[model samples]
Target: MSHSVVVGIDGSAQSRAAAEWAATEACRSGRRLRLVHVGAAENGTRAQPESAEDCLPPSVLSVRDRIAAALPGLELSCVRMGGSPPYALAAAGEREGLLVLGSRGLGGFTGMLVGSVGLHVAAHALCPVVLVRADPDGGAGAAGDVVVGVDGDRLGDEVLAFAFEQAACRGATLRAVESRALPTGPYVTRAPLDQCEIRDSLAEAELVRLQDALACWHDKFPEVRVETEITAHPAGRALVEASRAASLVVVGRRTPALRAAVHRLGTVAHAVLHHAHSPVAVVPHD
Candidate 1:
């Protein structure tokens, strides 16, 4: 209930990944770690199978032991929050906390919530929501850069604050990927022009803008190594490419008051959530 790293556990591979990621974040934030499960079975009256590894809501009672064995030295607790998983986690994060979940395969649905529960929580949660997808090789957290999608939009500062803090904690480089749309007017002539050269020039100018925005933070967190990628490609596509080697991908959604609708994610954030291979953090800001 207090400040804690809240992870949804279902005994799946992704769930374990989320739990591990949450544990590491908890260690970094100096907060407690709680493994939570929500199920439809009411009052333990439903017929249930007896498997120690079962990740059902009732397993919330036994998962603490197994998970504690895996992540020793960290303070861990387990509980079954009532009601739907997405709504329960959202309510838990309504105050000061972070909600972590495993990314399930949500097929072919754009702007739909990630894996139903994920998109719902990401879209509606009061605090930041992180979606963890373990490495294909079954590796743990990324030992590489912490990549964040930046558009110089309203939430740029808030996104950077979270990304920078995570980078500093992980001792990883911070890569800020910024994509800008180039106006296709007379400037883009039909002549045999140097397309690469024109793109480079535009990208360089955008790079300067990104640098200027991050200037103060660079000074504030001198320890965080910063890198920038400026491209004319779509924001979503560029970020998904960047996520290939990233440990975490940080993106922003408009705050509740500023957001016109709760369900729709800005183009880039929506795209990256579905495509990124690394853990994605949906941060809301004004």
Candidate 2:
């Protein structure tokens, strides 16, 4: 991956917030920052703008200048690309270290926390994509733990690596949550004590699995404090609750086997992106 952060610029307040967040991340990770704007083509088809000026609107330029002033010494560049916004941003993400976008853009409805474009790009981006919202009270940088959903599978290794790196970078605690469904039909017919025993036994096993999944990551980032939670609640609900006090929530998406097939964000990632109180990172894994 290129050591750079790419952010979509649409001149909206949300995109501006994303740009600022991307700049801070770039500074923290020692990566360059790129601002990209996508222009619509005539006849509603995907096409490139005629010139760079068409892509970099006055609002986009204004945001870039502000970021430059606030973050002196940081390398920055601007580009204008033409195509569908989601596909264009996803293409940029494939070539960058990380992709950041506003949770919602100019075309998003007021009530929607994550717009269609944000969801589409997050689902398809080859690299990790972060959705950030504007915070007027400076709450985005608050001291909070980095929360990640753990599945104890190969797909989760990539998610764990990203989460550990983010936690180490921020000097924050890493909270790994693994949610499992409890025993059903047979357990329901059992006595109350038996049901309780089953629940406790399941929790213990899941805790062990969660630890095993995180073993190497802990060794790699010993400086970061690690916390693990095994919940019987649904994965999405558990992560959403954790997100209330988290600075960032990291989740994984399984890439489809067919390159031409459309991909999905999965239920857990979709829930967190829509309801998480802080920024959400969706990492794509095979």
Candidate 3:
């Protein structure tokens, strides 16, 4: 099935960046773009109109106009809804396809890596979501490459395919991070890392295991350039840290309990969504 992209706009500089990215994606994929703007946050009551300036938020309207003008050839439609940004975006994406949002909005703190709305959509959106965060001057396009985190588990196969597809579409490099651990404590108490990884260290046996696991992907997408990194640390922290220079960080959610836990307590995926300097892409492993 084909997929269109729905973008959340608020006229914030960050939102504009997101819209631009979405427009680019839409144009490239020959898909449609839906621009959705949520009304000003209030006490669930409509605001009385005083002047034209106060009637609508400038950032919201400005982004709407800019995206419309920028992608005149693409199928673009705009919406002005009254509610929270995440809710509006989620509803819009329910039919169109993927949901896209900025890393931060006008209400966001300058120091925060990701905004509240981004966190909400990334956690709850029914479809895949992309959180855009790049300098307005266009540093994002040049950030170069998509980095995806994976453990040598059942989930890695699907995640590997998704990451490779995204990278191929974006003309970007793909980096797969297989996270393991190091034996730090005594051997008596040494055990598995809570079913996360079966063993510790990236020894010869571990490399062979990982290579064997990746044989399918290697055969399927032989032309797609990929780099593999075997990390010895916690998965969440390592992936989030790697997102600093990455254009997008891809992570997969597996199992119902794991999904709920990630959404609630911020798993490796959510932590990357909230803390990554770049945008994050969370995909389901099912």
Score candidate 1 by lDDT. 0.75
Q: Which candidate has the highest TM-score of all?
A: 2
Span of ten consecutive residues with least summed lDDT in model 3:
47-56
Model 2 segments beyond 4 Å from truth?
A: 40-55, 136-142, 153-155, 184-198
The digit string of per-residue lDDT tens for model 1 on 133-235 reads 7566644566679998887755357778888988998999999887777666445656676877776666678788889888898898999999987777888
lDDT of 2: 0.85
Query: Which parts of model 1 are misplaced by more than 4 Å?
Result: 40-63, 105-113, 136-140, 153-155, 183-202, 258-263
Tens-place lDDT digits, model 2, residues 1-286: 3678999989888898889889988998899999998885323545554235443567888988998899989999877788788988898878886899999899998778899999999988889999998777632544599999988655466788899999999999999988877566355544556767876776788788778768888999999999999888899999989988898999999999899998999999999998888899999887
Q: Rate the local accuracy (lDDT) of all candidates.
A: 0.75, 0.85, 0.70
**Higher-TM-score candidate of 2 and 3:** 2
- Ordered by TM-score, highest first, the candidates read 2, 1, 3
If candidate 1 were superposed on the true structure by all CA atoms, what would the RMSD be? 5.2
Q: Which wins on TM-score, candidate 1 or candidate 3?
A: 1
Best by lDDT: 2
The weakest ten consecutive residues by lDDT in model 1 span 46-55
